[model samples]
Target: MEEMPLKTAEELEAECLRLLHANMTTREIQRVGIVRTHADGSGPNWTYNQLYPEPTPIGKHDAHGIIASVAGKWALVA
Candidate 1:
């Protein structure tokens, strides 16, 4: 298997700041959510819906990875 590249905290912080300056809103950043599946396959699957409303269906972001780099630092915006 191929290994994933790692980034420094400072680098991540910088990227996040740049994204915010590029006109990304707090709500847009908040929409980035993670999904998890059960190992035993008996638990219910959960999802986050910001751009939509549905129990089993969740919303999506146009640029999720770019937004998530901020790591939920919505308070940083003015």
Candidate 2:
């Protein structure tokens, strides 16, 4: 199998924001968070969490900075 191309930081952040917006609006999720994982045996990976209403996995990202950016923006609105 061919290896997938890695996403840039900007792309990761945009995707995280998009997923957060979609979930918050559609699923009515009140709160969300990010968790770091090593399931891929890579250096680091991040997963979005739906903390309120229910704990659910929304999406995964590669950059922690991107995740932090999403969380900071969320704090501003939340």
Candidate 3:
């Protein structure tokens, strides 16, 4: 098998953005906010409280910045 050509930074960024949006929109992965439950079977377990589009501490906005940086248009991202 022949090796494929390396993708330019712009191509890579576009593909990354496409995949990110596709996955989120399709709900293939769920965004979750964890909560600690107790040992009484009701207070020490993890919970999914935050849904999509919520302001997560480390969210997709960060990935947008990375994409912009790769495309050499970080100003547009910010």
lDDT against the true structure, per candidate, is 0.34, 0.42, 0.36
List, residue by residue over 1-78, the lDDT tens digit for candidate 2. 332334434454455656555643324334445454434422335555433445334422322334565443322210
Candidate 2 overall Cα lDDT vs. reference?
A: 0.42
TM-score, structure 1 vs. true:
0.32
lDDT of 1 by residue, 1-78 (tens): 332243333444455445644653332342223332222222232222232221121212434444454443322221
Which parts of model 1 are misplaced by more than 4 Å? 24-66, 69-78
- Per-residue CA lDDT of model 3 for 1-78, tens digit only, reads 332233433444344455445544322323333232322221112222333454344554554443334333211110
Best by lDDT: 2
| Clashing residue pairs, backbone N/CA/C < 3 A, model 2 | none
Would you list the rank order by lDDT, best first? 2, 3, 1
**Number of the candidate with higher TM-score, 2 or 3:** 2
TM-score of each: 0.32, 0.32, 0.29
List clashing residue pairs in candidate 3.
Answer: 37-43, 37-44, 37-45, 38-43, 38-44
